[model samples]
Target: MAYTLYYWPLPFRGIFIELLLAEAGQPFEKKSPSSIYPDHRFDRPLPGMAPPYLVEKGGLQIAQMPAIATHLAERHGLMPSGAEARAAATKAILDANDVLEEISQNGGVQMWEEESWGEFRAERLATWMRIFEETYQHHGGPFMLGEEITLADIAALGLWAPMIHALPPLEEDLKRHAPQVSALLGRLAQRPGLEAFLTAQRARDGQGYCGGEIEASLREVLGLKAEG
Candidate 1:
C-alpha cells in the first residue's frame, strides 16, 4: 500500500493530494521541489508536465490534480456512490476550480484591486460559497455527499485553506456571508486524518503557500503596505 506524491515544496496545488491521502487514512511518501534530484530528469520526453503527481504500486504514475484526485477518490471509495451524488460532487469540484482560478489569478500574479475585492466580496464570493452550501444541504450536511466523504469535500477544504492562509481579512467576510462554509472550516479540521496532516503542515513550513512572490504582488496591486 505504499505510495509516493510529488509536488513543489509549497502547499498550493500539492496539498490537495495530501488531503485526499490523509482523508483515506492512507500512508504515503511525499517529495517536494527541494527534494527532487537534478538528474531525475528523463533522457526522453516524459508523460508528465509538472508537479502534483502521484506514484503507486507497479510504478503507476498519475499527473494533474484533477486526474490524480479523481483516481484516488474513486479507488478509495471516497467518491460518491450514488449517481446523483456523484454528479453533484463533480459539479462541486468544478465550482471550486472556478473559485480557485478567480482568486489565484494564474501564474501567481493576483491582480487584486480595492474595487475588485469589493465587487468579489459583494458579488462572486457569496455566490460561489452558496453553490457549495446548497449542495452540502442537499446531500444532507456534515459531508459534501451526505454521510460519505467525497473528493468534492476534499477539494473544497483544500481550496479554502490556501485562500484563508493568504488573506486573513477574508475570514470575517466568510463568517458573515457564507456561514455554512465557515462552519465547515471547523468540521473538516476535526477529522482525525486531516487533523494530523494539518498539524504537520503547520509545523513543517513557515513559508506561506504561493509565498511572498505572489503575495507581495497582490498586496501591491491591492494598495496595501509592506505588511498586511
Candidate 2:
C-alpha cells in the first residue's frame, strides 16, 4: 500500500517528503489539508496542529515534517547506517526545518519590514547558507553525507530549490554564500525521478513558494512584483 501525505498545496515542508519518496521510487497519495478540515478542526489521522502528515500503509500515522522525514528515510534506505550517522541525518533535517522557520519569519507571524528583511538577508540568511555549505564541505562532496545521497541531501534541496526558484534574486545569495550547497542542488535536480517531480511541480505552481501573505511579503521585501 502506498503512503498518504497531508499538506497544503504548496512546496514547502511537503517537498522534502515528496523528494524522498521520488528518489526512492515509492508511490504516495497526496491530499489537501482541507480534506480533513470539514468540521473546521483537523480530523487528522493523528492529533496534530498542522500538516505535512504521513500515514503509513501499516496503520502508523505520523506528524511533524522532521519525524516523518526520518521515518521515510529509514524505511526507504535513504538514511545512513549506524546510530551516529543517523543522528547526523536527523540533525540535517532539523537544521533544514529551522532554516525554513527563519526564512518564513516564524511562519509570517510578523510581516517582513524592509529594514528587518535587509538585515536578515545580509546576516541571518547568509549564516544559514554558510551552515549548509560548511556541512557539504565537511562531508567532502556532492552529497551532504559524502558520496552517498541520503535524506540530508534531499533535505537541503527541499530547503533551497523552491526558494531560489520562486525568488530568483536569492539564487545569487545561495551561489555566493553556499556555492557547494548550490552545486548539490544542481546535481540533485538532475536525478531522473526528482527532475521529473520538480518539473511537474513547477508546471503546476509556477514559482509559487510557500503561498500566502507571507510569500507576498517576502516578494515585496525583495522588490519583486507582487504575485497574484
**Candidate that would win on TM-score:** 2
Clashes of 1: 0
TM-scores for all candidates: the values are 0.83, 0.94
Write the residue-wise lDDT of candidate 1 on 73-186 in tens digits. 888878888788877777766676667666656655656666776787678887787777777667747777777678888877887765665566666766776677678877
Query: Looking at candidate 1, what is the lDDT of residue 128?
Result: 81
Q: In candidate 1, what residue range of length 10 has the lowest lDDT sum?
A: 37-46
Q: Candidate 2, after superposition: displacement of residue 98 in Å? A: 1.0
Candidate 2 segments whose C-alpha is farther than 4 A from its true place: 37-45
Question: Compared with the true structure, what per-residue lDDT tens digits does model 2 show for residues 54-154?
Answer: 88887778778998999889989899987876877898899989988988888889888899999999999999899888888887485898778898988
How close to the true structure is residue 225 of candidate 2, measured as C-alpha lDDT?
A: 89
Where model 1 places Cα greater than 4 Å from the true spot, the runs are 33-46, 219-228
lDDT of each: 0.71, 0.86
Root-mean-square deviation of candidate 2: 1.7
